[model samples]
Target: MEGDLERNNHILGDRWESMMSGHMTRIANEKGLDAQNFRCADCTSPIGIFYGAPRLCWYTGEYYCQNCHLMEENMIPARIIHNWDFRKHKVSKRTMVYLTQQWRDPCIQMDEVNPSGYRYIDELKKLLPLRLQLATLEPYLQTCRMLTPELLSTRLKGLHHMLGNPHIYSPHDLCLVRDGLLYNAINKLVQFGTKHVRQCALCTAKGFVCEICGKDEIIFAFDDMTSQCQQCKGVFHKRCFADRCPRCERRHNRNTPL
Candidate 1:
């Protein structure tokens, strides 16, 4: 997980630099290009005074010939990252193909890419809590040997990643979020997982009893009313375990040399 995060951070850095360069190119081109030797950005085909000016690709802010830029339209990652814009713009065929292939890759980290953008996207805000709950339930669900992939296939459908990891999101996922479909899908997944853990005998055994309250009810670490000890990892009712964990102290006394 640490390695994955480090790789993602590196990718984000590269993407940020590319987006900034593209933005600057667009700004510079706003006033029109000066008379010079023109060529396609991809194929390097001459599109000069004799062959007319090259077509502009809205994605990379570069010029390309008709063969290279077939007027294909696609969502720009730069626009999505910087402004959360989903509108498609005219792009080169190569750019379109690349974007399409990368659409389903879980690379985008919205918090790092655009922190303030979350405030503008209400659906994303709603999805955040559901993802957090799902993240918490992942370990319990995975421990249930009886729980098969076939059982979850219908509920998860296209979003198997929700069960595995919650932080990373694909561009396709964001599109679904924008359409107000992903939230419902994830909400149902959380409900399904919660139900499974509560009912399954294998999952139920994993639940922690509130040591402080000495209650018969089995509670999970994910429960809002439960608190976990940082040292001993003992779970207890929030009200019962006010600040400190007694179990940690007891364990410490036992381990200490007399």
Candidate 2:
């Protein structure tokens, strides 16, 4: 009986050690994976926290720097998945595959005017009463394509501050929460407009100049090289038309008697 008891105790001791060892190994592995997961796939650098949140690509289940994600101004990915705390599901390999396939590309192209992000069109129209005079306005609008929700908020805030007419309550005063994205988009639009808009196609009632290149020698006889918007009645260079006039296109697509 003594021998049996000693044998049982030895067996229990061995089992406990094995279990503890397994648990420790699992913990080590988990820590390693946690580090790996947050490392940027492109740069191999650990993704740093931006505004207290870790920067990561939501769809790919991988890390990416903010600059990589943005790529350029007004070119934000439509289905960019943010790793917000409010996310319904945690990103994993299986979820990433599913998301990638589901949101392969946006239904509306990037150059195409997204109706959802067109709240500023009316405001812009109000600001610029003499639309036909600014020959490059349409092209500038086209180049200033993206208006992410974050960007839209920034724009509204800027406009509110500039106008200062007490139209809306202050975000700070009201304790309203807002996304903490950098407002480079507003400046980006301003820069592009400043550089690109030199002439207007519709300013002169007679001959139209190419708003995109600022060249007056556009061959209007070729219907393909030059086209007029049905809604805004704005003429565009063929190459420019192919590129699209985002503002007029957006306005047309949104307010068309649908």
Candidate 3:
């Protein structure tokens, strides 16, 4: 009976420690942690309370000794993900290194992680449409044989990845977005791509004239005023195509072998 009691006590102690450790790791600010619980989270060193308490890392909300902390400052990923806060805060050496390495990785899913960021952040709201526009214009720009790599490089600068996939956003990209710098860059890129598509002869040849309206105006699939048929890939003016694509019906009739 005594042996079983001792084993249970050990199990309970381990569980309590694990819970506390998780809670400490997730604490966002110093206020969440007790001053009496000060210890180096990394090295498990007990810092002297009278001589000097361990430094608090803003990122992990845990205290660390001087050897572990190194007084490094970095932007907290949790703060950025939750509050859209871009301010740099004092962090531990390990946190600083981890965030620096993750800066360029497209791992943050803004919509899934913090949907409110788009609704609250005016810059993010503005940037979304610009990215969508660039995404739409990408196919036209990519398929055009006349477009030079130098011209595209000059226009797109460092945003070529956005054309392929606009949903993914890196921490570095988010920082620029928060600063209102990326918005202007994406806007300019969309404008440049749109102008090229509309003016270039090869690109214009790929545009479709609205079959319903019978207008000579060239319209691309990306145009907001146009709608596309899922079956035949026919493009028509949104107003004219209302419920169905007449071109699809006509094509079906022709292919029926009457």
Candidate 4:
């Protein structure tokens, strides 16, 4: 019976849980509950990094522990990206402010359901790299806020109709609940580029039309003997990688993470 119980627990282990918010009481609120401590209730170790979990508090915007809170939506982080029309080049700087301020909102409109809830290899398969998505979305976020407030309202309505169930909506539904709500906020900002523009990621130099020019002038993205990372197909002059690997490529072993 003990072995059977262990097997059952392991099977249940992989499920996503979203209720760990303990109903959004402050960190102090759930203290000493024993039933809802932040540690792994099973192994009793610290799991306090507090990352993505499906269970979120509708009241407080907080990520919960998944291990102790099984059978609920596993909150994995996903950064939402959208088009923004802001013309400023401060993608990196603006993103920092937007994120800090936006992190406090309620998860109002998103859903944490497995995009294909019952079919994927893991229930939390929709989980994406938080930093990766955030980085990608930063370039487009600042200008999305320029959208007329009406469009934002209409978009929310469309989402509500698309995913909201009769009784409960997952915390993921809220712009606040998602990893890069700022990305989405900026996605809705006004956008202006057209006819395609390619710029040097390193120097932000613009208007290079040829790969050779890109290779010789910019000094990266060329696959010279010294400039290759196993992760990204980015080829660079040897000096580029030795100085700093371009974002496109980095060394990764079979077991290594990208």
Candidate 5:
């Protein structure tokens, strides 16, 4: 079974490479430049480093931001890419950083279901990273106004409608909404934001499972400080597994989420 899973992963990795190569070629052709000189598919900026490496697309093999990459993977609502033209809503540098921290980055790797019963996922606490949540309420908050809980819920429901009512929308419809949203959101942020940093792709916890406890849920996702073993690429809840890898029996330093 483990072998099969590894085989599948290998196959997926190869397919991703092929598709990405094709994507880059297409972009290069569109822009009349070699893929090597091309910038991020969304931002068109030179790649920068974070966590000590140039931020390259896992699929596209191009420099890209974590937020845009997550949007590409549907980790966040693709619609947010288009929900508002952030370029038009520009603020000063100080305010921009504050807003990015408070309103923007939070939405990156957000869970599908939010605390206020405004959920994109049917199950509670089942995460859909990069999907927006109460952070969607940020624009309203910045206006120095408050949305009653009921109003917030109503607005969420309405946004869900604009995204084709994911609750009742067919799987195909959901894909369409996500694709559209991603394009719009990525285009705007790459153009407007003052700072761009590479975020680790694994931070999303998309396929992570705990080796020590054998439960996936409640394991850490972005910046939650979960412990990881470098050699085995295995993750564990810090409290459950400490100092040694249960699978490899290797004793080494554990890394915390960034």
Candidate 6:
């Protein structure tokens, strides 16, 4: 249905033609919506809002393809409740978000939405407001595509850690982050035709570094990079690091086995 401005034009009688002209122009140029996009979930084409028998409800602000909120009124199922959660699903006892309520239509279930991680979550990705998903994912995926294994050890690993820093808006938006790091770190050498990208940061080990210290001391290279030492300032691999510092519980004045 058209808004007050458009409806008022139909009533004004005097300026109706000009008002109609402006309205048509505005409709033709709507931002992310054209007659061809996102489709009406039922008719497989686009038209705005419901004119059918109690069609889908566009709650929560965005036009959802799954919700089918813009179809004709007759096409809309009367009630939709989420069976998984009682709060979202009390529409009826059958309690399934089916495409229609007459018990004949196929249910639009979430299992069909793909249970894999975000990397494979295209249905969820598709549900993202169409205007922004490509714009957002494109640059991000491009950066992901350009990653050489060598740069991944530091760049990709840190990116994963930073996403979980508890400062971002939605930390869950990136549950795939740690996994992404591992994926990139593993496929990195293959993608760029290299050996190891990042080195173990703890005691100079062969794998990635420890989360404790930002050092590459997989073998216990002391200093500030490795874990704090009980020995002098000298850091060593966790196993090799001997407690010889002044605070050492095992330090003997004589030359001890340390």
Q: Hey, what RMSD does candidate 2 come out at?
A: 21.0
lDDT of 1: 0.74
Q: After best superposition, candidate 3 residue 135: deviation in angstroms?
A: 0.7
Candidate achieving the largest lDDT: 3
In candidate 1, stretches whose alpha carbon ends up further than 4 angstroms from where it belongs are 1-37, 48-50, 228-234, 241-258
Error at 40, model 3, angstroms: 2.6
Residue-wise lDDT of candidate 3 within 182-226, one digit each (tens)? 887887787788888999999998889998879979997667787
lDDT of 5 at 39: 47
lDDT score, candidate 3, position 187: 76
Candidate 2 residue 173 Cα shift, in angstroms, is 28
Ranking by lDDT: 3, 1, 2, 5, 4, 6
Name the runs in model 5 displaced over 4 angstroms. 1-206, 216-225, 250-258
The sequence of per-residue lDDT tens digits that candidate 1 reaches over residues 178-256 is 8888888888888888888889898989888887778899987667787878777688888898787889888888999
Alpha carbon deviation, residue 149, candidate 1 (Å): 2.2
Instruction: Say what the RMSD of model 1 is.
Output: 7.6
Q: Highest TM-score, which number? A: 1
Q: lDDT per residue, candidate 2, 58-77, as tens digits?
A: 33434455434442221112
Clashes of each: 0, 4, 0, 32, 13, 24
Model 4: residue 2 alpha-carbon error in angstroms? 57
List model 4 lDDT by residue over 1-258, tens digit each.
999999887766543123323222212132332355654434444555444433332122332345434333222222221111112121112222333343443432222322332233221223222222222323322234443447545644433222223112233333332344533432332111111111323222421222322464432221123344456434455543464444532233434765
The stretch of ten residues in a row with the least summed lDDT in candidate 4 is 189-198
lDDT of 4 at 114: 27
Model 6 alpha-carbon drift over 4 Å, by segment: 1-173, 177-227, 230-233, 243-258
Better of 1 and 2 by TM-score: 1
What does the lDDT read for residue 8 in candidate 1? Answer: 100
